[model samples]
Target: MTVLASSAPVLEVSALTRAFGGLVAVNVIDLAVHSGEIVGLLGPNGSGKTTALNLISGVLRPDSGTIRFAGQAINGMPAHRIARLGLARTFQLVRVLKGMSCAENVKAGLVFHRPPLSRGEIDESVDRLLRHVGLSDRGGLPAAGLTYIDCKRLELARALALKPRLLLLDEWLAGLNPSELLIGIELIRSLKEEGLSILLVEHVMDAIRSLCDRCVVMNSGRRIAEGRPDEVLADPAVIEAYLGVSPGVSTDA
Candidate 1:
């Protein structure tokens, strides 16, 4: 797994802004991810975390600002083109096709690489990913029949199929129970070991503190604090915005 340490920035966002009619979804946000790092993006509900991911993934165009991937300008590129550039993301809601099997759902991710690989190679890669996610035996199951956790895993498997240099995940653990959260956290940790850069938007404070090297806190579509997880979590403004209490405030006081 790869962890960031003052290395070259793999993904850069410069003054990114997005709006929906009268609403400013993402407001002039600037952020970056290095070659090997796990960076956490956190905020309360309706914060711009998801909007930022969509802009970065090209799922939605930015009203202003720029995005660069691997040092190349990619602001206006289509989502598929961005995927081809080694950037992939999983949605907060698993978006697998109900009619497809688990293996087929993941196979869709492999499509970006183009000109199909030899059947042997394809099978080996798919099987390995399935096994890695502990779903080898379930690969043939219809996606609609899989449990919610399995659907999340399938989403992850599909994202990994792109061989992404950076993975953007939106609340991957949302709706999961304790056991499922643990598995997701462990999987992410393992991916970091494999040198995959990750930008995760999560509401789970424990997961962020344990798994992230740094945290970026956003409020009302703008970044308010960023640093080591503990430091950011302790910021007064961050606590006020999300935790509903200012840092150092005591109920007795």
Candidate 2:
């Protein structure tokens, strides 16, 4: 796969902050994902990783900040509008249309495309996407009947149906078994190889190590560090934030 050499970022967030009542969920976070880059967003629970994704994806409006995608300011834009611009995301929890067949669920995501696909084209695209996500034979099955891993796969197919330039993956690797985790990692790498920029929010340390070109560490709704994965993971602030102890201190002390 050929990587684009464009200097402009595919997604950019500056001083992004969001608050719910008196609680600040995300605070002054600046992030960027350039074309063909897979960046990991890592932090402990309640550290605002998912919240940051929501703000960037238009699920929640930022209280203060600017979000630019493909050179257009997208802050406060409706979710569907942002999606039409090639920014798509998967939820931390697998969400599928329980009543719809797997293929139908994927077809629903295509509703927003500009040129409007014909019936035959839509069917062909749906089949190809289901096959891509390893759900080729399950297209006729109701989505509710899929196992947890299959449900995740279905969500991925649906996201791909949008033909996004940038994909935000929130905890897509959370509940997979060892083998399933390996498959998930390979799938992400393949997407990256195809020139899809990704912002990944994941708890699996091994997957993060294998998939991320750069890592951003967050804690208490703030960005603590951003650098190469090995460097960020070894930073004193990241270690203390994740382990709740100083780097040199013994936990048993």
Candidate 3:
């Protein structure tokens, strides 16, 4: 069920700001992800895109402003608490338990967010999630044994095991080959079709253009543009901020 679809956004940030000593990493940014939508958080390196995701996921607390999730103010909540609250995420650099089997990794997610499950139910969930991320055959292998792309898939499965209402993906598609990228895009699309809300910080323009219903662009810790992926990516200001090209105008020269 797509709960809390119209009454409020699945995720909302208003005037969100965060700073580290002398530098401001996130500066009064505002954005929202509605239910059943995938919103691309796009920016170049060091554009505070990841930092913004960190704040939303409770890895870092905002210095000011507010974060609301499912109509509740979630400012300053701890990361684990946030995850248990039906928001889950994967990191830019995939985090996995190298010592654990892929199935164990997924089981960790289930038990973390859902501890009352019977052993049979946990096993069923782990198998299903691994299959969902195309790792059904590899579930018995060590997480360290998987290739980089496969590890990414494993991380996604673990996050899905949380059954999050809103999922934050921080550059989860950064290291895939062309074929793998296509598969990754389709996986994410299938999740959205299943009624998941996502905020994706992705560098792959093809994925962004294909998957995102809306895009929010950031430059130097502030939002520079927001709109349809194609339109926002084409905006002169966004182009300038992302590509360092001057917004040129032709005149009698």
Candidate 4:
């Protein structure tokens, strides 16, 4: 878990910016995620966290900036191209293929990896990913039949099927009840323990505090703070801008 500052980051962004017509959604922001680390992207709604993820995952091209993943440049690349090159992501809203069974959704992701799995291999891998995401019993169900939280799990299972080098998770823990939230946190933590690099955008402070190795804060399309989770959460500006609390108040209280 000791990140070598001198080592190249698994994901690196420099002066990343994006705009929509008259509005600047992301300012010149710089970020990096090293191997085996989870970096939390924190901000209020509309603060450009999702915009940044879109840009990073190639869902939307940045107006300006550079994105390097696994030592390759990726700004302006198509989302499928990015996924093929070892990057995968989940959306802020879960995106399972509604017409497909849970296993089929994962199978769709499985076919993309090199050395394509045989039919049996694909089936076995799909089952493993389903079990990993706590959906082993539901693999035969249609995605449209899934509950909200189950949809989130199915989406995660599909993303994992890509075997990505870095995963961009946009609010993956949102909308869970307390017990489900704890399981969600632990699921992400287990992913980190497996040495997967992650950039997580989350509003759930508990998940961010428990799962992130470092945190990045943004406001009005610009990065405002970056540091350990506790350090950034304790920052006066971040508390006011994101947590909606006056300084000196504990968010956990």
Candidate 5:
């Protein structure tokens, strides 16, 4: 895979803002994500992390902003159109067809706004994706029967079926146990090694600290800081906004 140059951002957002009525859900925010890197977006609930992802993935239109992916404007493009442009995102909510088999569910992703392929091709493609996500043997099972963690993995696999240049993931580890969290983290790491750029919105501190090369913290619809994991996590502003004060942690913000 061809790696992207550091100077040229794979995704860029300038002055992104979204509002509903009199309330601003996301204020003017600017961000740039380079290829082959994982950048975490974290904050308290309603901090606009998911909203930011929605805007980038074209699920919701930004009230004012410019989003350029690979040098092309995609701010107002529909979600399906964005996917065709090598961007794909997974929802915070698990969106699986309960009655469908795992293989069938994965196949759905491949057909997202794309021309249909032959059955044999779809099967081969889905099987390869399932294997990549460590779900090869589970493909024949119904989606509803899989455990919560497996379901999450299935979602990741489906997202990868798009062969995206950039992926926006929203809080995928929400309901997972410790073991599941580790597995999920490992899978994300593997993807990064495969040269996929990622922007993840997650609250799990451990995952963010371990998986992301850098992070951006948001609070009340505004950016607080952006830097390496340790530097950003240790920032007084981030700790105050998310972790709250403790006797041992710094109180100044």
Candidate 6:
């Protein structure tokens, strides 16, 4: 796998801003993901993590500022268009085609890729992806029948089918048990090893510390701190915003 230096960012957001009515969801946030880095996005609930992912993936348009991927300005582009440019994301709330089989749902994802594959190729790719996500035996099952963790894996397989250069994962570890979390972490690590740039929004600190080379902390729609995961997590601002206590202040009675 090719290692990405910090200077070569594959996804760049500069002064990005988004708002709904009077509520500013993302306020002039600037972020970047280098070609092979897994950057963690950390914040308390409603700190604009999902909103930022939406903007980056084109699920929502920014009210101001620029979003560029692979050197192309993608601001205002439709979600499909952005996805076709090799950017893909998984939702916080898993979304699968309830009526479709697992293989069919994965097939739907391959439709957006350039130079469409033949039927046989698509089928083969679907099988391979299902195996990669540990759903090889369940390919014929209806996605709706799968458990919550299986749904997350299905979504991940679907995202991988897009053959993305950059992936935004929103709370993918939220509902997983310890063993499931280990599998998820290993899968993500393997993807990163294959040179995929990932932006992870997760509440699991252990996962963040294990998977991320760096982290950005957000609060009230603004970035509060950004640095190495350990450093950022230890920042007084981050502690206060996330834990509601000033760093170094004892809570002991």
> Considering every candidate listed, which one attains the maximal TM-score?
2
* lDDT of predicted model 6: 0.93
Tens digit of per-residue lDDT, candidate 4, span 26-93: 99999999998899999999999999999999989999999999899999999998998889899988
Task: State model 1's lDDT.
Answer: 0.88
Q: What TM-score, over all chains together, does every model reach?
A: 0.95, 0.97, 0.94, 0.94, 0.91, 0.96
- Using lDDT as the measure, the top candidate is 6
At residue 11, give the lDDT of candidate 6: 90
> In candidate 1, residue 58 scores what lDDT?
91
- Write the residue-wise lDDT of candidate 6 on 1-253 in tens digits: 6465456889989999999999999999999999889999999999999999999999999999999999999999999999999999999999999999999999999998677999999999999999999998888999999999999999999999999999999999998999999999999998998889999999999999999988988999999999999999889899899888897889999
Expressed as tens digits, the lDDT of each residue in 94-184 for candidate 2 is 8999999999999998886556899999999999999898898888999999999999999988888889999999999999999999999
lDDT at position 187, candidate 5? 83
lDDT against the true structure, each candidate: 0.88, 0.91, 0.90, 0.91, 0.87, 0.93
The lDDT of model 2 is: 0.91
Please report how far candidate 2 places residue 185 from its true position, in Å.
Answer: 0.6
Q: What's the ranking of the predictions by TM-score, best on top?
A: 2, 6, 1, 3, 4, 5
Deviating ranges (above 4 Å) for candidate 6: 1-6, 250-253
Instruction: For each of the candidates, give the backbone clash count.
Output: 9, 0, 0, 0, 0, 0
lDDT for position 87 in model 4? 91
Candidate 2's displacement at residue 188, Å, is: 0.7
Per residue, candidate 3 scores C-alpha lDDT tens digits across 147-236 of: 999999999999999998899999998988999999999999888988899999998999999999899999999999999999998899
Per-residue lDDT value at 25 in model 3: 89
Clashing pairs in 5: none
